[model samples]
Target chain A: MYAKEKTGGELSVGGPSVRGMTNAIVVERLVKRFGATTALDGVDLTVAEGSVLGLLGPNGAGKTTVVRVLATLLVADGGRVEVAGLDVGRHADQVRAAIGLTGQYAAVDEYLTGFENLEMVGRLYRLGKRESRKRAGELLERFDLIDAANRPAKTYSGGMRRRLDIAASLINRPRVLFLDEPTTGLDPRSRLAMWEFIAELADGGTTILLTTQYLEEADRLADRMVVIDRGRVIARGTSDELKAQVGGQRLEFTVTDAAVLPRMVERLRPLGVDDPVVDEQARRLSLPVSGGAEVLAEALRLLDGDTSRIFDVGLRRPDLDDVFLALTGRAAEEVASDDDTTAEPAMTGGAR
Target chain B: MSSLAATLSDSVVITKRNLIKVKRVPDLIVFATLSPIMFVLLFRYVFGGAIGGLPPGVSYAEFLLPGIFAQTIVLGSTTTGASIAEDLQKGLIDRFRSLPMARSAVLVGRTVADLGLNAISIVVMGLTGLVVGWRINSSVGEAVTGFLVLLLFAYAVSWLMALVGLLVRTPEVVNNASFIVIFPLTFVANTFVPLESFPSVLRTFAEWNPVSAVVQAARDLFGNTSPLAPVPDAWSLQHPVLYTLIWVVLILAVFVPLSVRGYGRAAGR
Candidate 1:
């Protein structure tokens, strides 16, 4: 029943380079519910082989639910889901063999030494005794944990535990990796280190499905992104395409005085897609515009002599944060505060 | 390797992981060994001469030894539940579940590792019992059989606790919940006292209680029972070995599948 391909009729959403690649993960009309609350509603997504697909959403948007389903940790209520070309429901063990999962919480056993943790995970992955030890040593060195390999994980810092967790996930050298908010609680320095590590993994041709609320992380790592909100897909595209969907670029000018704002707005009016927004207190004027650098040039030409009043002018492209807000109608920071009230241990916390 | 062989290997790996914690955590060693010795000392000195209903030629200390063995082993089984709940709370179970291993390995590994702890506790308690006035009058084979029965009953109880752990999914709650059920289950039976002294209604319940049967079986195997004592009229107490084995088999049959299924759907909450 799982051998037949169901991807034949689906439209390709990625670039030509991604078109020829087989999908490592495929989810069609997925549905998951907890009691009366629908966690995922008819969600559809695919991650091409050796490519990173960012599953972007707010705290409760079911991003973790999608990852859990693909990782074979949670069974979907209604869907045709496949990972590594194996049905998640029927061939869950085969799917697990091909996938690696690093949950939000560092799942390392605190009492075990770092080496023991990795070696245990390797053995569970069916790596033989000698091979498990060898792999544990290799992963500890690779994750820069060799110095602390014999220390219990309870003594390690949060970042070290997270690294150990990720290293344990790579015990089998999984083809598809699911990292659900891998850097959620790390400090800025540790977050940067995690990003570098993830980049290295992505470069090694591992298909990654990364779920994160950090838009900057997605913008940097993902080849394509599927944005979900309130258990449904709201947008799906590359970073630039999603940005473009949020009304293109903005032309902004920091003026010498608030008086020149109206004149500047009139001059840049022809180039903008919408009416100009003027701020009197800050002496700033912004116009939503299209056509990129040429539009800035056109605006500057229209303001030939009036340029003296404008101290700074540039075209600003919409960022993922803006796209997130425009799509979800809630800022990422607000969604984080909302998550604290409904926290459950295993469901939406880390495992799911 | 075949699938069954793979499951056995996987279970051994997980069992090793759990045993490592026992060596590292000082608190666990204290709880496993010290508490049983404390119980024996408290009962032997504090209440040993106070309660007396034993028949001729049988010492209260000898009778209390098998009861202590049963109680300690049963209480020791709670560690399995607490550890499992702790794993679930910290998301370690999620990591294990996502791996390409046998589904039953986690529970099997936990119960088996805990069985090791119970063995260590028995050795400690056995030495402590000898220091008081407890002695095994039976042959070596019968004594070893007595110890085996204690461990087997504890193993079955571990599966029952595993289901509780998966249901509650918190170490603290599992501790409290198991205490509520296990306290009366062990106390109201023949564990700490003879079933003959109980009021007629309580005596009937004690005679059939699984803990009483297990304690009675241990006493019979160790030759702690005196011929002058009243013979149990209840069939379960009369054939204590068979009754205990039946309960062990019945508990394993009901709880093993319940726990595995509960674990699979635990993340759903």
Candidate 2:
């Protein structure tokens, strides 16, 4: 029912339907545990054919676990998962055939050249020898790796390796693709480049399930967002919907004197829906409010003739960061940094 | 394509990938060949005089050559375990697992490629043996059989190493752990010396040790065995070729399924 409801909004035009299916990937109440630790508990999501669902969470929040299970690399402790209309548990081989996974770390063999890596994957996918080579060449060209196609993957830069990895996953033209942190450690330029590639893939109508810590990446690429934390879906919506859920806009003011903060909050209190946040030490007041420019005008009128006490004033709409803070009670970067010291080393091969 | 044919084709793909690594990283093949050559030179010139239990017609070089072949291929098989562990650590196994190919392809491909390496090592060791005065005394067929038996045993051992690789799941640990078991398994056998010289307990081990059987089979086929030498009492050595084939079969039977199962369950940490 949910799958039917979600389809046809922005499904790509004339996308190939390999299995003549609607929902490309679906999971119902998935449960997974590692010994006493529960990595994923009762998680559920779906990706419509030719749509992207961004799985957002902090590190160790079971994002990778979900991807692994859907990719048929790990068996779930309980619940049902299907990719391309085939159950992962009973028809793992079929599921593998329909789905491709690019893991958190680049999984290319460093010893093999880029062309050779793609060709090998293609052959394994049961493409005939000539077809496999042809597909490899096509992918290398598309990924802009044709120049270095004959060079070993070890010599490629971080971005190039990531591109090659994604290219290898695409060799079989899988119906569903799982990308776990595709641009995790890339530079800004490379991240932008990867984003463009992902956008192009999205435009081509490939069904994708992307797990990422960068909210900007998810916001830019994912049509829908599912936020998970500690093995549970805490929130799910489009970028604009999630932002709106955190409330409309904020009226913020910074004053030269800490003593003026409370005065500012009192003046704007009636205009805001909730309590205005006052920080004496920072000498600032931030209040949530509805109406657009008129509210700013009214707030300015309320503080008219008291402008000498205010250093700055502005009306700001909530970004995904605010929504994340409101929902998770921790900044994204804080959780990411905390996770780095505690998470297990990913064991990236030669291309550091 | 049918399932079996698909599996075979996938296996060939993986095998080619592994062979490319062998060519790209010369160190892997170099060490595999160099170590056996070192063993040949060490036993031939340095310890050949100190150990004097050889039969009259059999030179120490001839007697030691078969043992060195057994040691070379058996130890060379560890490459399977080490490379498997490396793949697991590097997340390549995870990538392969996610693919639609046969689950057993990774193990089959690895052992097959390692078998090729074992063949190369054997050839190099053979040439080194000739330079050191070791000669084949039997007909060409027997010598060819000797080579086949050695390769078969190495192929079997590669599966055992693959299981070890999956169990340990790290290249450095696989290297260290394999040696702890393999060193004594090779040395306690008749690899470096005549079985008659070993202590009773060690001699019994050597007589039944697959490594010793392989060495004895090679010696018999290479025409290096001497009539004047004291015959081994153990039935395994008395019928060395049969004993060696049985071990190869048994090792393969036990390790192939175990390795494949372990590989399927190995989730890259």
Candidate 3:
């Protein structure tokens, strides 16, 4: 199936018959509970046909559970999931054919070479022998793995293996792709490379649903984002909208000397700097400001003589981490180590 | 018409992938191939003289070859369970479960690949037996039929192993479980010696044993005289063909559905 090129930016791929309902994924009041603990409670989400929706949460926020249900790998205890306009429970085979899944860890066969792995997946999707090999070759080139295609997967680096895994999932040219924590343990460079590839896929009109703990990744790639905690949707909005909910900007300044911290705080007080706190050890003064960059410039002028000697001075806006803390009542960093953090933001569900 | 043809075509592709896996892992082939040859040699050379009561004009190698044929097929089938368990441990099966391919094709393809390996092992063991003075007096068709019977028995055993592989959570547990049951069953049958040599009560059980039937059928088809040929009871006399076919059908009836059910349960569907 192929789409005709249009003047508009939308790059549709599949036939018109498959695009009747433009929503790629729809979950209404989705709830999944593992024994006594509820992993997903009343989670509602809708992904557009050709956009990337990032499901952002800390560990145990049911990101994996949601993906599993959508992929038809695990059945949800309650609520309904629809993929590619087919009911996941009733038409699981249809749903599976329409969606591709790349789990958190690489799932390529270690014994097989990169090319062989892709070819195997291609055959499994029922492509003819010649067509399977052609598709595998194209994927290998696109993923920048052609050179290492003949090497066994076990010999590849972590990044190469992850790339191979993603390539394998796309053998069928699925309409919807699910990536669960795709870059959890990847190096920064490889993570960025993967993000670019994901963005490229979205650009080519593939609906993508991804889960990640990294807020920056969500901000960069997701068209719409949802913050989940303790198996519930705590916040959902565009990046700017979520940041707006957690009001004000951060104004940070570091004095040249430890003794000058008090003076710097006093000089910047009239510039609408609130809650000024001094760290004697690092000789830094930080405060919240309601105004934007202009206020920061004015504050710098007030300390004109010491501006050059200031260790650091900047106005920072609120990010998803702030929204997470404000909504969940705990910093995202603190919750990273707690597995039950997704079960209950409060201290109810004990350590797993 | 086209869609049905496409499905069949896809199944062949899936089957080829499994064959590639079998080829890549030469160690599995080596184990399946060498184990049978070694068993045939050990039984014919080391233990043949120790056991008596072979009919005149029948060398121990001739009598031992058919039993070794059955033994080799059974041993090769155990790898089906081991491979499945290993795949489960490595999360390969879980990955396959998420894919859109035919569900039944996955396990069936694995069994088919294992059956091919079993055939190779059977041929290797047969050649080794010939080198050791074992003669097959039967025609080419009879000899081929003997090998087919052994292969059918191996196919049935593979299904049982597939069920065990799916039910058990760990590879080590599958190994221990299959070995504990298979080793004793092989020993008590006529794999090493004729059933008449056992205690009278044990002889009755061995006569009805599926393993004994397989060995007896192979021995009769290959024209190798067995010590139990003198038994005149209709049930015992008919053991050569009927019992082997019965066991094959029975195993297929039980294990094919058992494995599919186990897969559903393991997937938490």
Candidate 4:
């Protein structure tokens, strides 16, 4: 059966089972609903034991719902899910023991100190008192929160609090770690720092399933991605594969003046392989082309003598953004921004 | 270890986490104490003379101290609802669920920690009652029993609050809604006035109310009962301890499991 190829033999490594197991997470035809709303609709996903599977979707698309279900925090109405080789529905405690989850918002207790939060998590994991304290100290140091360890979590900045939250999840060094928009509200620098920390964990062979609206995050850390919209998987592939599906390259340029855009478009259209798209605000125009470099160079040659100056010019292949647009029929960022306005601003239903 | 052992240990850990919050954020406890003190001072000086139908020869403060103890603890239990709702909003309950700990730990810990806060409020209010001429005329043994009954009843009600807290979305909603429910419960009883003063139909409901039974039980135990206090013909007031214990058992039997179920749903969602 297909299940035989997925669940592997027992663990050999000490932390995270390293490369021993083949599938850390698997969901088939999963279904969930809240009142009249079906939050998850027959979705399937599989993450090899040590790889990262990014659950890429807009907010309220039920990415958190799927994560919650896999983490044994939600009961699926239909189908089967196994995490760390244990059935999520039947062996929920075992599944919970094998996984760690850092939610969309940091879930650390604000009244507890950073050290206290980690230690409490460890103690709940059944680590003895001494060991719990030891692990708490180690994790705080690893997260670079040692200095603030004695202060309540409420005193930490957003990024510091997020780090402490992630550290609490790792107190037991779970085999499968789920991060729900781990960098949602951070500055660009903190986002990069978080990416590096997540990458380091991935390098240690910890399986990760992350949901994100930031395409750049998926592109940066995910080995494979499943794009879901409105509780359904619309596309799934490696970043490049998704990009390639919405195929072809575009010749793009920004002219000095908005009025000269039509002239530039006219010059590049004939050399173009397909229709051109213009940006009035950016004073930019792009044309799909068959010949890679040759067409780009040829387009520049034709526009060389034009009176209007060119601020920027380049030939570009599609990224995950284009793939998301092609599959969802909407921009990823737009759907994400819509969430900020439409959904409850804080963690609520489906957070678990 | 066994499942029960694990649950107990997990509960202790979570209880410690909650107790730490009380220590760090003193406002909830402060308000818990302050409100009861306000009630004592108001009832003793302001309302004491205006409240007619009180029996002669007994000071209002002496007649009313036991009722205050019972009422304070019940109102104080709302802290359970507020604190639990705050945890639900903060997503900390979800975090606890993700661990391998006992599913019952979060609810158990919350009620227990709130019990501690209730105990503190009771002590502070007791001291305030003393300063205001409220005295325990009975022996230490009976007073101890009185306080135990009060704490047990409050603990049971705290579980009911736990269920509400888990069912609600925010601490503010829990605070507001619980007051709407708890106010009538405490006020309609023999807490602020004598049973004879209540209209006949309302008097029946007030006498039988679990809040009244506990208050009556505490009044008898503390030797605080006087001619000024309500003397009802109902069996509930005649056997206040037994009646209060029945309510305690009844509330526990229903709300304990319901709160646990609600907690599971809260975490999963």
What would the per-residue lDDT of candidate 2 be over residues A73-111, giving only the tens digit for each residue? 889999888888889999998888888889988999999
For candidate 1, give the lDDT of residue B192: 78
Judge candidate 3 at residue A335 and give its lDDT: 71
Model with the higher TM-score, candidate 3 or 4: 4
TM-scores for chain B, listed for all candidates: 0.97, 0.98, 0.92, 0.95
> In candidate 1, how many Å is residue A68 off?
0.8
- Give the range of the ten consecutive residues with the poorest summed lDDT in model 1 chain A: A343-352
How far is A122's C-alpha from truth in model 3 (Å)?
A: 2.3
Q: List, in the given order, the native-contact fraction of each candidate.
A: 0.84, 0.88, 0.56, 0.81
For each candidate, what's the DockQ? 0.69, 0.72, 0.40, 0.78
Window of ten residues with lowest summed lDDT in model 2 chain A = A343-352
Interface C-alpha root-mean-square deviation of candidate 2: 0.7
Write candidate 1's Cα lDDT for A218-250 as tens digits: 888888888888789888877766776777778
DockQ (model 1, Cα): 0.69
Model 3: per-residue lDDT, tens digit, B1-269?
25556546555665676677767778877877787888887888799889887766778999898888887788778777877777776656766777766666667777888898888888898899989989999899998898899999999999999888877756778778887888877788877886668898777777777888888888889989844457634385466787788889999999988886676545421
The candidate maximizing TM-score is: 4
Candidate 1 ranges with C-alpha deviation above 4 Å:
A1-10, A13-18, A247-321, A333-352
Q: Which parts of model 3 are misplaced by more than 4 Å? A: A1-21, A33-38, A243-326, A329-352, B1-7, B200-204, B226-228, B232-237, B264-269
Q: Rate the local accuracy (lDDT) of all candidates.
A: 0.85, 0.85, 0.78, 0.83
